[model samples]
Structures are given as structure tokens and as C-alpha cells.
Target chain A: MKLLTYFFQWLMSLLWVVALQAQAQPTQPYSYPPSEVVRIHSKILNEERKVYVHCPKVDSADGNKRFPVVYVLDGDNHFELLAQYIDYLSRPDVLAIPKIIVIGISNTKRTRDLTPTNSLLNYEGKPDSSSYQGSGGNEHFLQFMATELMPMIDKNYKTAPYKIFAGHSFGGLSSLNCLLTHPDLFDAYIAVSPSLWWDKEYLLKMTDEKLKHGSALNKMLFFSDGNEGGRNSFFHKSLVKLEATLAKKKLKRLDYRYKHYPTETHMTEPVVAYFDALRFIFKDWEKQR
Target chain B: MKLLTYFFQWLMSLLWVVALQAQAQPTQPYSYPPSEVVRIHSKILNEERKVYVHCPKVDSADGNKRFPVVYVLDGDNHFELLAQYIDYLSRPDVLAIPKIIVIGISNTKRTRDLTPTNSLLNYEGKPDSSSYQGSGGNEHFLQFMATELMPMIDKNYKTAPYKIFAGHSFGGLSSLNCLLTHPDLFDAYIAVSPSLWWDKEYLLKMTDEKLKHGSALNKMLFFSDGNEGGRNSFFHKSLVKLEATLAKKKLKRLDYRYKHYPTETHMTEPVVAYFDALRFIFKDWEKQR
Candidate 1:
């Protein structure tokens, strides 16, 4: 009986020591791709805007090197995802793309700033005044990006001349809008599931008007759609029309690709589309290197 | 001159205020999915092990709910990526998959812990002594996982009975090895580019011997190969053989998928294969609900 009690006591002490060691072992937060939030007061918008900036970890030898930037809209939704892709693709082992900076712009007035024309029509072609109350500010938004945001980013960071604009849904519409209105603002454009039905296809008509046949518009573009409604849906039809229009124009140096994901839904489409878009943009990049 | 001086002073004051405001605007680290590192002393492996744990954010309504677990090998390389995918896929907005816990097992001894046999020959059939010094301790490692790690996770976190084992490359070989040797260890297995050429195709032969024709092995498996070598390469050929063997077996209730990504390299394959595997495993999930 005495031996049994002694064995029990020994076991208890061992358990206590093991527990203490487990607690004492050093642990740290799972560090993700290093990213930061920067705040800037925008004069054009008359509001404070916050953006998430993710830059690749620089080598000591390449501290002064500049990197191309990808300005992503819907920052709150897709910044970290883009950041993760950028980091992984540009890793030492996987040199699929060059190390680039990702600037994610968060929204204060998403609808107002993303829509090209003021209209209250919902996706079902019905009036939705509550959701579309303060629309048609995308032009001003572009001006702010071109003049204020771009200049600020260039001045503060080691930025290269090359830049890419990326967005999804309404944000995607804005990206295409920027390409048409302010072509020199970015070198590449990604519009995933863009709301081409916005204001009765305002951006689609704008694309036709702005991009001329045989015009020397050197840029890369990737646009895609998932199963928002299906093949006959306005979403899919608009994408097909956009593709056809671009092909008909045969504009010089406008490299573009359109992908359709039938299995994915609208919200889950960006997860795959963004990765594909990045791969498309950088497809020729590895060969050039 | 007096008016100019006054205007200059006003402009200077405004600039100073703007600078101060920029400095004062609250900035915080980009918050990632909350994750933690756990240290465990494994008596089976006779060493300490570190695992990464990433759980979905618990809603107030789901305080007592349990989650399925995915145990991923190569914690250092792919944990963050999988965590990101799970968080995005299981979001309230994007209900592509259910919320689950991810356990990433970090490697202490890579070759010994991951390989199934003691072999000095690499993919090229060349003897590499240093690299294969301590090969073939995977059985003990799996024991550590089943006896030590899973129990600890179950005791600490709200875990469901459904479990998945995921790995890549050599880790992928171990995943297949576990499936063939200890079929009841996990409900699902994901082997992304398993090095089937290991020990002159030991696991491939083991699969032939262990799994009987039309056997009732109720499990899900996803395996794939990327551009490790071209289509005619041994890597691709071995995958073809494995698929043929499985097909010939006609194992009952063993849901399996084989994907080939010709565009992606061996290293880059995991990025796409994992997403596809998750989708495949949960393909019928929505309809069941």
C-alpha cells in the first residue's frame, strides 16, 4: 500500500513537470505574409482612406530594388489572398512571377465609387434605390487613384513603373472603367465577374467606344465569370459579349484572356480567378527571364 | 507681399496638421486567421514535436459545436495556405465547405519521418547517403500522430469524428503509405505528387497486396501529379500505374480522384491540387444538406 502511494505521488509530480514544460515552451503567433495598413487623407474624396500594403521580403543585397505594384479593389475581401499568392509565386523555389507589391484599397463608399453611371436597377432589372442611392462616382475615384493614391505610393515606396489593377464584381466594373477612361494608370487589368449589367451595360458600351480597331493599346487584361445565373444569364452573356467585342476590334498589343468557371458561385469565384489571372499575366514573364 | 506671406503660413499650418493626422491615424498589423503553435513530447517518436493549429472563428451560436480536422504534413510550407483556403471557403458568404480545424505537423527529421522505406536512391536512381541517412520511420511517426497528437487535439479542441490526412511530395508518399498500411487512421487522404518511385515502388506494391478487389474500404482519396517531369516521364508513368491498379481493384466505397496538372510544376502543384481535393471531397456535401 505504501509503495502504491509512492508510485502515485511520483506520477503526479511527473505530470506537473510535463504540464509546466508544455506551458513554458516558447510559442509565437503564426506569422503570415508580412503586411501593413497605411492611412492617407484623400483630398479628392475629402475622406480618410486606409490601404493594406504587402511587400515581398527584400534581400539585403537588393534593398534598393523596386517592385511592380498590384492595386487591388475590395481590399477587405481579397487583400490577404492576393498577398499570399504573390508571396508563394515569387518564392525562391517557385519563381512563377517577380516579387511585386500588393496595395489593397478598402472601400468607404463602394457602390458610389465603383459605378460608372447613377442608376438604381438591381441585378433582376428592378429598382433598388436603397442600395444604389449614391452611385456614379467612379470617374472621380479614378482621378483620386491616378493623381493622389498612385503618386503617394510612388513617392513612399520603391515602386516600378509597371502596375496592375485588380477587382471583383462592382470593383471589377471599376477596374474595367479605369482601363477605358485612364488607360495610362495601370499596365494590366483584372476584372473578375464584373457587373457589366450595371446601368444597362454602361461599361460594356464604353469599352466599345474607347477601344478602336487596330489601335496601339499595349496592355494585359484578364476577365472571367462564374455561375452567377448560368449560361443564359446576363452575367455570362456580358462576358461573352466583352470577349467578342475585344476580338472584333483586334486592337494592337491588347493581350487578353477570358475564363468561365461553371462550378463556382459568384462569391467563391475570386479564389480561383485571381490565381488564374496572376498566372495569365505572368505566363510570358518566366520565358522572358 | 503681406498677403503672400499670410497664405504661406496658412498652407504650412495645414500641411503640419495633415502630417500629424497621418501619424496619428491608428494602424495595426494585418490580422490573419487566428492560429497557434503547440509543442508536444511524443513517447512513440522519442522526441518533441511541434504542430500548428488553425481553427475557424467560433460564432456565438456555435459555442459548443465540433469541427472536422485536417492533419497536414509539411506544416512549414503549406499550413498558412490551407488555413487561408478553409477560412475563405467556410465563410458565411462563401459556404463552399464547412468550417473545420487544420493541424499542420512541422517536420523535425524530414526523411526519416516521411519516407516509407530505407532507400538511398533518389528519383534519378542515384545513391545519396547524406539525404537518406535516417530513412523509413513513417510508421512510428504515424503512431505518434494517432496516439499522441490526435488525442491531444481531441482533448483540447472541439473535434468531430471525420478526419483527413494531407501531404505533398515525400510527405505525400507517407500519406499513401498510411492509407495502405493503416486504412482506419483517417477517413480521407490527400497525396499531392507522392514520390511513388520510393524504394522501387514499395507502397505501390503494398497497395496491390493490402487492398482486396471490391473490398469495402469506406474512405476518400485524392491524388495528383504536376509537371514533375513531362507526360512520358517516370513520375507521370507511376501515377498512371497507381490509377490503373486502383481501377483494377474496384475497391468498394473507396471514393478516389486522380488529377493531372500539366501546367504546374511539382512545387507549385500543391496550390491548385489542394483546392481541387477539398472541392472533390465535399462535392456531394451541398446536395446531401
Candidate 2:
């Protein structure tokens, strides 16, 4: 009887301790919509490339439905922000945009893969050798993406034909490079604070060269610059020049929007710029739906 | 010898199948900064309430650093976004705002807790009994937050003295209600598109009565309205009236901002409003830091 009493006491004490622990420590991690970190072997790059992908939650109604893909550069910096925006925008209540499969391509040798020229000349036309060494591999990088990454993603995910190419800074430079060099690669493009000053206005010159006057380039483009180097700075001037060049083109079907966030800093611009870009890209999405 | 040969062949085929499966499958879930879902037993509300808490990642430098807490309503809709925003804004590279804790208070009987009054009248002043039944428990809800939720949170977490209260729509109404009734409860308040037409603008009248004219109300208030109900909307009118009332008071030490997102829809307004509010609230954060 005494042993039985002791056992009950012991059990009661154990339960009490558990209750205290529960009170002290909140249980369970807050659940976020699930996303995956995917790795695919790229033969063109000759190395494994990692990408962050976030797909919409599939329900019974969307059993066989496919989604558009938003392939963003600088995955580590901007992937989650894009994913969060997409999720919120596509919520049943919000419905600002359709559900999307976000593909965030993280970098390997950022300058090398993102820059269009092998020149060591910096934004200021100074030969910053250490920074610009082995800088011209963007063509090869895009080739790897076109031949390897896209095919792998298309094969594995429930993807529609529509795709968006998005990037910031050097990544932004690469985005414009991709669009000009291979216009058919993506249906839409977003370049937030592109380093247009790269290699003595290489992209700005390329923009003027590649795009034709009165020609049709059917795609949605969102290009933006913040108060990066200020109003009179070359960075801002380069953006203005790019805008003027595009205006000069008068392309027949190129739906593009250029936003100047005078209030936002360069690092902070992507947050608002990405949101504005998505909204611009899908301005008539609801009406169409 | 024949049995050994058969086993070797079987092993080789199994290895090949494994390799194929590995190629097909992309392993691992994308990691997000961790957040906790805390279920605290609430005596005031007489129910177990669940709140989502996200703290900044503490490092060796922050061995015992306490952080400010932001208590936001509509947890299910906005918690993760706030968490994502705080995390990004406080990043070393993008130090727009200081690192802070985010607490997302989800709803249980939202109308009961968020509305300032029990009237069944809709925004159009028609009785909407079914939609608004069991309304006007906001005072009790605030009581629950102040006496129960905040105390419990303060006890469990490493919290600083400062706190921010944020909400949208009806939740926005509740936020304004809290600011007026319990000004000491939080250091700052954010109301994103507050439903000012509630109970024939009960809180708007309260705003006039509660705040003393030309008196010091040393707090940060951010209130905004989207293009809700359109240009000539009563909703927009009410917001304008609220702004006018505050202007009329000319209250001392009241740091406030009123934003009108003419391009944003009622639903889509919160995303930009919340971001803008955070930026507004911490506009001089970098300078101070």
C-alpha cells in the first residue's frame, strides 16, 4: 500500500514537472508554407548548382494545375521575400497574382557569371583588377541555365509555359543581359538597381545596340533604381540613360515599367521594387482571371 | 559461385536504381528563420489562445540582449510577413530597422474581438446581423492582451520595454481602439486601412473625445487608407475626418503619419501599408543606431 502511494506520488510529481515545462516553453515551431532547396548537377557549369523553390500549396481544386515560374537571382538575398509576396498576393482573399513556382538561383562566382565583359574596368572605368578578374562568363552561365537548370526544373515541377527572370545589382545586370542577348528566354523580366555602370556602361550600350527601333519585343519588363548613389550620381544617370534609350526605341509590344524609388536606399529598394514589379507584371491578372 | 554472381548482379542493379532515385528526388526543405507557436492558457478570455512569436537570432554579441516586441493582429494572414520583414530589415547589410521580436495574435471569433461596438449596422448603415453577430468584445480582448497575453509573453521571452501594436481592417479598428483606451499599453500603433465606418464611426468620435486638444500624447501613430470603396467613399472620408480631427487637436509630442495608397486595393493595401508603417516608424532608426 505504501509502495503504491509512493508510485502515485512519483507519477504526480512527473506530471507536475511536465506541466511547468509546458508553461515555461511554448511547444512547436510556427509553420510556414513549405519550400524546398533543390540541387541539380549542371554539366555546362560542371558543378552542382543549388536553387530555392517555393510552390503553392496544391488543393483538390488545383490537383492538375500548373504554375508560372519566377526565377530570381541572388537567392540568398531575395528568394524568401519573393516567396512571401507570392504567397500573400495569391491568397484567396488577396488574389493580386496567380500562384507561382519561385526558383531562386544562388550564385557561384557572382561577378564572373553575371558580368557580360571580360574587361577588368570597373564602373568608374578604372581597372579594378582584383574585383573584375575572370569577369566574363555570363554567356556560359546563361547557357548552363538554358540547357541544364531550366530543363531539370521543367521536368520535376508542375510548370506552365510562362516564366519570369528577376535579379538585383549584378544579378540585375545579368537579367538585362539575358533579356537583350536571349529575348526568348523568359516571358517577363525584373531588374532592380542593375549595375548599369558595369564595364563603362556595357549593358547600357548593349541595350541601345540589341533592341531595335519600332521593332516588336513582346514581354513584360520592370526596371527600377533607388537613391543608390543619389540623384546626380553616375549610377542614377546610367539608369536614366537606359530609360531614355528604351523610350527612344518605341518598341511596338514591349510592356515595360520603370520605377524610381527616390525614398528607398539601394539595399532596401528590392523589397518594394520586387512587390511593385510583381504587381506591374500582373496588373491585369485579376481582370484576365 | 553461381549464387555469388547472381547476388553481385542484384546489388549492381539496386545501386543503379538508387542513383536514379537520387537524381529524380531533390531532398530537404528550405530553411526559414525559426519562429515559435506559443499556446498560452488565457484566464481573461477563458480559452487557450495561440500566438506566434519570432525572435531575432541571438549571437555571442547578444548574449543577454533584450528586444522590442511587435504584437500584430490577423496572425494567420500577416505574421510570417512581419517576421520576414523584421528579419530582412535588421540584416547587417540592410540595417533599415533594429532587430525586434514579432508576436502574431491569431483570431478566434474575430468580429467579437476586433469591433469597437456591438451595432449590427454594415458600412452602408444597413443591418448585417448574421455577419456581425456576437460583436464588440474588443475591450475585453484588449483586457486579455494587457492583463494576460502581454504579461505571459513578457515573462517567457527576453523583452525590452518598447512594444508596437499593428492591425488591419476590423483589426485596424481594434488597434485604434487600443491606442485610445490603453495608450500606455504600446509605444507605437499601426492601423492599415482601418474600418472607420464601424458602428457609425464610433472610434472616430472616441478619437475626438479621448485625446485632449494641444495636450502631449507622446506616441507614434501610423494610420492609412487604400482606395477602399473608391474616391468618394465614406471609408476614405472617415479617414480624412480622423486626420482632420488630429490636425485640429494640434496635439503636442504626437509623432504620426497618414498615408493614402490611392493605387492599392483594400486587400492588397496591408502589404505596402505594413512595410511603409515599419519604415515610417523607424525612419531615423539608422541615425540613432
Candidate 3:
């Protein structure tokens, strides 16, 4: 009986030690909601494109629910950020925005596809032939997006009709270009620090020509610029001119806002601009929904 | 030979179909860097505290490097956001800030631990028994953080001496409480729309009493208030009074800034306030580093 009691005591001590150690060990690393990488062969661009898709977790209450989709450019740079924002803002506590699908279209040939015109002229309006070579393929890229990528996303995901296109820098230029050329493609567009100095301000001119006076756009557009050079720089000047042009057009139902982050740098602007743009785009979403 | 050719053609056709189907399927879901749930048995709190710890991916060059830590309250709400921010800001392309560890302290009893005073009075200076039942354990909570949590983190992770404490609302109340009482705990403090109205404007009163005339704090603090009840509300008034008190102190080496987000609400404030606070705290870090 004495031996048995000692044995039980030892066993109890061992279990206690094990429990204490187990409590100290952390649980498995927590993971963010997974985003998938989708591969599609584009007939228009004649390239195999890889895109990142982030979908929301659906509850039983969200039965047969279709989500709005935000297609962002420069997938490698900004996909995760947008995905994070969409998830957070759409949480049950924060119904600031609805649960939306984020489709980040990764680049194949960034320079060739993002620029709207073929020109050697740089931001300084000087020739830089090597950099500007094969630059005017944006139309083909847009066709690829319109005919190939969008269809693929809509076919695969539980998608709503409301679509948004977002981008930055060259990607920002591409976003604005799409807004001007294929305004019907997306319901909203975000252009963060668009390289408005591209090809002798080609898109700025296009924006003026395409947006007819007193016309109905029925879309939301949020564009902004950072202090790229200074107040006197071409980058700032172009954004001001674009804003002025939009004002001049007096396009009815073209819900748009141009924000200038004077305190931010070109590189650092996107972190804040993207959040602000989302808020501006979906300001009335909660009440409307 | 003809039979063999027919077999080869059939194989090729089969292969093509298989490849197309394979391409249509999405690649594995892209994952954000994971954060672990660390359970620490706090003798003071008499319960297990779960903290979300997000560590940066260390490369060969960073083999022996240590990182500063930011301890944020309301882990469940804001942990992911801070993790996302740290990852983006510290990227090679961004590099606005350095790689840092984020420790988000999830709540067990939020009200009991966050409030500084034992009072039944609510934000409106009226008695509310049910809501303020177990308030005024902040000092004990701070003690738990200082004695139990910080040591465990230091022991397990590669930690730098510099630390930051961030909180919002009631959590913000705790942060300011810590700053006033245990000033040595953190290098920086961020209070986003702090509940200065707690206990009939208790913290606002405490702030004035704590800072000695021309005292050297040698710390950084970023405090902001949103349009939480409008310009005439006590929320705005309390923040203004706090700022005025800090200014009157004229404490030496206390690098602080007060930002007012007239556009943001109490709940939506953290989204922008946190970003702005981070920028303010790390404004001189790049140059200094």
C-alpha cells in the first residue's frame, strides 16, 4: 500500500509538470483568411496571367450571398493591404463597408501594359528610350482584363454586379485610363498618385476629352497625389490640372473627389490613400445596405 | 506506325485537356505571415492571458538582429491591422519603418482592467452600476504587464529595449494611465480617442498632476480625438484640455503631438488614427537610424 501511494504521487507530480510546460507553449501560429492565386491564359495579351483572389468567410446567414469585387493593379505590391482592409472594415462590429472580393491582377510586363501611350519622354519630358519601349499596350491589357480576367473572376467567385478598380503610380495611371476609356467596366475607380506626367500628360488630355460636359457618369472616382517633387513639380501640377478639368466638365452624377496628401511622399502615400479612398467610395454603403 | 501515331495524337490531346483544366484551378491560397497566440499564466490576474505576437521573417543578414515591440490593447479588433502595417512599412520597397514585433493583448474582462478609477459613474458623469461594476483594476493590470508579460516576451523573442504602448477608447484610457503611473514601461504611447470622460474626467485631472514643471520625460506620445459627439461635446473638450495641460507642463524632451481628426468618429477613428500615430512616432526614425 505504501509503495502504491508513492507511485501515485510520482505520477501526479509528472502530470503537473507536463501541464505547466504545456500551458507555457504557445498555440499554433494564427493565420489570416487565405487568398488564392488564380492562373488564367489571356488570349488578348497572349500571356499566362496569375491573379490573387481574396474571398470573405461566409456564415450560414450569408446564404446565397454574392459579394462586390475590387480588382486592384500591381498585385504584388498592394494586394495584401487591400485584402486586409476589406476584411477589417466589413467585420460585424465595423459595418463601415460590405464584404467584398479582392482580385489583385499581377503584372507580366509592367511598363508595357500600364502606360497609355508609346513615348520616350519621361516625367521630365526628356527621352528615355530604353524605359519607354513597348509602352502603349494598355488598350490590349484593358481588353485582356475586360474579356478574360473579369469573366474568370465572375465565373469562379460569388460576385455581385458592383465592381471597383484600384491602383497606384503606373498602376494608378492604368486605373484612370480604364475609368476614361472603359467607364462601364467598373462601378468605382481609385487612382493613388497616378503618374499624370506620362507621355506628355496623355491621360490628362484623354480625361478632358472623354468626360463630356453635363454628362452622366453614374460612377464613383477617387484620385489623389502626394508631394512627389514639390508644389511646383509637374506631378503636382498635373493632378491640379486634372482636378480642374473634372470641375470644368460639370459631369452630372460623376461622384468624384480629388485628395492631395501634401504631408506624404510618393512611396508612402498609398498606405493612407488606399484607406481614405475606400472610405470615400463606400461612405454611404452601410446605410444603403 | 500509323497505330502508334494515332496513340501519340490521343496522348497529346489528353495532355492538352489536362493542362487546361489544371490551369483553371487556383494555386494554393496565399497566406499572410502568421501571428501566434501566446498564453501566459498571470499570477496577478489569476487567469491565462492570450496575446497575439507577430514576429517579422528574419533573413540571414538579420540572423542576430532584435526588434522593438509595440503592445497594442484590443488585440481582437486591431491586431491584424497593426501586423499588416508593420509588414508593409518595413518592406524593402517601403522601408518607412523598421521590422518590429507586435504584441496585441486580447481582453478577458475589458472594463475591469482598462479603467483607472473605481467609480459607478459613466462617461456622462451619471451613476451606472452594471457597466462599471468591476472597474479600477488598471494598476494591477499594469503590474501584471510589467512583471509577467514583458519578461516572458523578452525571454522568448529577440527583443530590443524600446517599446510602444497603443490603445483606443477604454484601452486608450489604460494606455494614458500607464503613461502617467508607470512611465518607464514604454518608449512611446499612442492614445486614439481616449475615454477621458471616465470617472468624471479623472484621467484629464491625473495628467495635470503627474507631469512636474519642466520635467524631462524623453518619450514620445501621439494623442488624437475624433468628432465623437461633435465640436461642442465633452469628448472634444476633454482632448483639448489634455493637450493644453501637456503644453502648459513644457516638459523637457517629451516629443509629443496632438492631432484632431474632425472627420473621423470614435469607432472609425482608430483606422486612420493608428496610421497617423505610427507615422508621427516613426517620423524621425529613418533619419535617426
List where candidate 2 sits over 4 angstroms from the true fold. A1-25, B1-24
Worst 10 residues of 2 chain A by lDDT: A1-10
Q: What do the candidate models score in CA lDDT, each in turn?
A: 0.91, 0.91, 0.90
Docking class of 3: acceptable
Q: Candidate 3: where is the Cα deviation over 4 Å? A: A1-27, A287-289, B1-25
Evaluate residue A213 in candidate 3 and report its C-alpha lDDT on the 0 to 100 scale: 94
- Chain B TM per candidate, please? 0.91, 0.91, 0.90
Residue pairs clashing, model 2: none
What does candidate 2 score on TM?
0.92
lDDT of 1 by residue, A188-260 (tens): 9999999999988888898899898889889999999999999999989999999999999999999999999
Tens digit of per-residue lDDT, candidate 1, span B49-108: 999999889999787889999999999888888888989898888888889899999999
lDDT of 2 by residue, A174-280 (tens): 89999999999999999999999988898888899888899998999999999987899998999889889999999988999899999889888899999999999
Report how far residue B122 has shifted in candidate 2, in Å.
0.4
Judge candidate 3 at residue A209 and give its lDDT.
81
Clashing pairs in 1: none
What's the CA error at residue B9 for candidate 3, in Å?
32
- On a 0 to 100 scale, what is the lDDT of residue B285 in model 3? 83
TM-score, ranked from best to worst: 2, 3, 1
